[model samples]
Target chain A: MKFLSNLINGISLGSVYAIIALGYTMVYGIARMLNFAHGDVIMVGAYICFFAIYSFNLNPVIGILMAVVVCTVLGVVIEKLAYKPLRQATSLAVLITAIGVSYFLQNMAQLLWSANPKVFPTIINGSIKLFGGELSISRTTIVIVLVCALIVVGLSIFVNHTKMGKAMRACSEDKEAAQLMGINVNKTISMTFAIGSALAAIAGVLMCCAYPNLQPTTGSMPGIKAFTAAVFGGIGSIPGAFIGGILLGVLEILGSAYISTELKDAIVFLALIIVLLVKPTGILGKKIHEKV
Target chain B: MAAMLEVNDINVYYGSIHAIKGVSFEVNEGEIISLIGANGAGKTTTLHTISGLLKSTTGSMSFMGTDLMKTPADKIVSLGLAHVPEGRRIFQGMDVEENLDMGAFTQPKSSIKGNKEIVFEHFPRLKERRHQIAGTLSGGEQQMLAMGRAMMSNPKLLMLDEPSMGLAPILVDEIFEIIKALNKAGTTILLVEQNAQMALSIASRGYVLETGRVVLEDEAKNLLNNDSIRKAYLGG
Candidate 1:
């Protein structure tokens, strides 16, 4: 019974990671550039949502929408101003630039919002119980799961069926050929970043609601966990990221309950290492054959 | 017919190495023009320069009397110039239909459906495997997809580089047949090929490039029968 309860908790936590993981997967799929500042962007989103609720006294729904919009614009701006100028530079340089941006955003948040953890008002205060084991699920957790599922479905449809999605797919496969086909590579890349960041922002809001605690550095652990999920499923595959996130969440919860809480992150990392060692391409990733 | 594309003394460099030194040529409208050369003979470089993938260091390229040297690669497609790069750079992860749709990215959304119908009409095989991932396809199928993708843009001039690099003899014949059929349908083509015999046989006019220079240019039939071209490139 206790195991079942922990399992539910794990899934709820994993759902949050899955939402954040989608952003990492989407951006990495198209641009092949690891935006190190992605985690910080999550923090930025949380802070924006916080201010909207506390400072502006806006409704939770409006606050969430505003957070998504602001984060998306910030993402676009980051790509245009920071990444675009260094398009021709080495990958290492771009990676370093990403790190610089990450630190810059983190410090900026600290300066603006302070380092103290601010209490987030509960958007979903109710909880439902199930089974003899007393399975309790929060409204915030339900909303988070539903929103993540919606995003995943929406993204899959966009990539599989729509015109812009097809263009993005083409760009991910062969950027130069897509350009020859007259797809604006820059615009597509920018749009990818914007969408990915917006998703991250939503994940941040749901996380704040569930935990009800906000800090300048709250995004770091979740971002790393999402990245782990992205790698576990297949960095380039959207579906893979979804599965990976949930799996990670479950594993962490189970480990904390049965094993020790101190070993939770360590155990997860160990599993990741073992999985990677066995299958370098990941569980769902396809191996790319380079032509001579 | 007026020259659809004029390459006037274009010099292309890779870092400091002069890959194409003042190479000049003219592609007339509605004609199949073949640029035949050995490895590293600036055939691909010339195509890249004209397609605006690589800017010329010291020359001018005009397309339909418009200065095309300064135009970006993506914009060149809308200007009625479609480039099929070497190695058939198809979007491997996408399906056949998706790859074809990408070719029509510059056009209005309304025309895309119509263009897709035309592409399917030309290559019925692509229509069959419209939902199949391009990377999973055979080399010949991939080649067909590449050509089909280029045609989807409805360009006035189509540039193809080394379309027969790796394929079975039958697939090679099929590709050449498609090229001739495309030409007969009134689409001007710039063909860069190492298979000189087949290229010269189908081309209206041919140019032999050697070490970044146009060593010879003549009617395809004339070049086919020429002693030097026959001995060196045609394997006579």
Candidate 2:
């Protein structure tokens, strides 16, 4: 029973990681730049939701939607303002710029909302009882899992079918070739950041619901972990992010439950090392398939 | 035949290195113009400059009277210019059909299907491998895919850069035939190749680029039979 409960909680947590990891991977795929500020986007998302619901007294759903919109705009703006000019700059320059953006967001949040952790309300509080409540699943957990599934599904369809999505993939594959094909690389990049940040917002709100704390640094840990998930799954592949997140989540939870709790974080990193040692290209990373 | 593309003393640089110096050429409507040169002769650079991939330092490139310097690289395709760049720059990861779809990316969705079928007709091998990744296709097939991809846009001016870089002799002949056929079907062509003999055979007008300048420009037959041209380029 304890194992099963841990498994459920692990999935709940993994889904959140998957949502966040999707943003990291997608932004990396299109922009060819690692957006270290993605985690801070989650912080911005959480604060927006908190302010909308608590300060403005808006409906929780609308608050979440507004958070998505604001994060989307923030993401596009950040890309244009901070990243666009450095499109041709060296990777080191871009990396430092991303870190600078992350710090700027963190410090700005601290100034606006204060460093003290805000107590986020339990928007959805209920549980599904199983085995006479001995085994229980929270409604929030179920919602997070379902919503993450929807996002993954919806994103897959969009990337595989839509025109803009095709352009994104093409641009990611070959920017010069895509441009010659008449794809507006700038617009495609903006759309990619917008989508990634919107997913970040979803993960952020769901995370706040799970933890019920809205601090300026609330998004840092999850952001780092989700980035791990992306690297573990093969950074550019979408399904890799999903599977890597869930696997990492389960490993962390199971390690905590079965092994020492003090070493749970270490276990996750240890598992990532083992996976890399064996495959090096995450689970489904783009591999050199032919004898070219 | 009206001049579809006109270049006037354009200079292009790779960083501080002046790659193309005082190069001038013109392509007429429905004519095949070939730029033949040795390695490092600015053949690819010239094609790239006209495609807006590289900007000229101090000269003019006009396609159908629109200044190419002002247009963004992505918008060059919409201006009735299709450039099949060196090494067959097809999206290697995308499938054959998806690549053709990308070729017609500027065209409306309703027209993509029809454009794709036309491309397949031009290269039956592409039809067979519509679902196969482009990287997996043979060198000859990839070259065909590149040409067919350029055809998807149905541009007024089709520019090919080293379309026969690494293909069998028979495949080279096959590719030139298609290039000739496309020209006969009313598409103007600007071909750049190191294969001077075959390139000059089919070209209506020929320009020999050496050290970033047009060393000679004349009707293809005249250049083909010229004593110095035959000595240097045709292996004497």
Candidate 3:
């Protein structure tokens, strides 16, 4: 019964990471740059939602939508202001700029909202009991898992079937060639960031609802963990992110429940090291071939 | 023949080094015009500039009456112009059909079906391997895919850069034949080639580019027989 309960909790947590990791992976795949500030964007999304619902007394659904909208716009603005100019710059320079952006966002959040932690409201409350109350599952877990499934399926269809989605894939492979094909490379890249940040916003709200703790630093740890999940599953593969996140969550929860709570994160990182040493490409990362 | 594309004194630079110095040429409607040059003779650069991939320091470029210099590279295709770049830069990560779909990026979805049919008619091999990843295809098939992908836009003028590059001799003959057939079907061709003989053979007119300058311009037959052109380019 405990094992089943832990598994459900792990899935609920994993779905949040998967959502956040999707943003990281997509941005990395198309922009060819690590957006280190992604986690901070989640914090921003949470704050937006917190204010919209708690302060403004808006409905939870409206708060979530507003968060998604704001995050999407913020993403486009960040790309234009910070990353676009560094398009031709070296990877190291871009990495440093991303780190800078991350710090900037964190500091901005601290200044705007103050450093105090707020209790995030229970947006969805209730639990489902199975097997005569031996195993219980939270409604939030069901919602997060369903939302994650929908996002994964919807994103797959969009990338495979839509015109703009194909353009994004084409741009990732060869931007110059995509330009010749009459694809607006810059616009496609901006769209990628937009989509990624919107996902980040949802991840933020879901994470806060599950844990019910809102603070400037709430997004950073989960953001890094989701990034690890992305790398674990094969950074650029959509299915990989989902798998990686779920596995990471399961591992973390099982480690804490069975072994030591303080050592769960360490166990997760150690497992990542071992997996990378074995496969190097994560579970689904394609072996890139250099064309002569 | 009415001029479909006109360039008046365009100079292109890579940083401080001038690659194309005051180069100018034009392609008439429904004619195969060849730009024959050795390596680094600005053939690809000229094509890049006209397609808006590379900006010219000074010049006027008009394609179907639109000022090409002021237009974006991606917008050039909708104005009925297409370029098959040097080295067949087809989207290698995508499948054959996905690559074709990308080729029709600027076209309407309703027209995509018709455009794809036109492409398949030209290269039936692409249709057979439509689901296969592009990078896995043979060199000749990749070249065919590149040209067929360009044709997906249904452009009035098609610029081909080194369509014969790094292909088997038999494949080269096959590609050239297709170029002639495409031209016969009323698509204006601007062919750039290092293989001077094959380029001039099918072209109605030829421009012999030497060190970023159009050294000689004449009818294809005259350029094929010119003593200097034969010596420098045709390996006489």
Per-residue alpha-carbon lDDT of candidate 3 for residues B199-233, written as tens digits (9 for 90 to 100) = 99999999988888988999999999999999998
The RMSD of every model to the true structure, in order and in angstroms, is 1.7, 1.3, 1.5
lDDT of 2 by residue, B1-236 (tens): 44789998999998889999999999988899999999999999999898888899888888998999889999999888999989887878888888888888898778888878877777899999999998899989988988888888878889999888888899998899999888888889999999999999999999999989999999999999999998888998
After superposition, candidate 3 runs with Cα above 4 Å error? A288-292
Q: iRMS of each prediction in angstroms?
A: 1.5, 2.3, 1.4
What is the C-alpha lDDT profile of model 2 across A235-259, one tens digit per residue? Answer: 9889999998988888889999999
Enumerate clash totals for all models, in the order shown: 0, 0, 0
lDDT of 3 by residue, A1-292 (tens): 8998999899888999999999999999899888999999999999999999999999999999999999999999999999999998999999999999999999999999999999998899899999999888989999999999999999999988898999999988888889989999999999999999999999999999999888888888999999999999999888999999999999999999999999999998998999899999999888756343
* Candidate 3 chain A least-lDDT 10 residues: A283-292
Show the colliding residue pairs in model 3.
Answer: none
Model 1 misplaced regions, further than 4 Å? A290-292
State the weakest 10-residue window (summed lDDT) of model 1 chain A. A132-141
Return the top candidate by lDDT. 3
Q: Quantify all predictions' global Cα lDDT against the true fold.
A: 0.88, 0.91, 0.92
Sort the predicted structures by DockQ, highest score first: 1, 3, 2
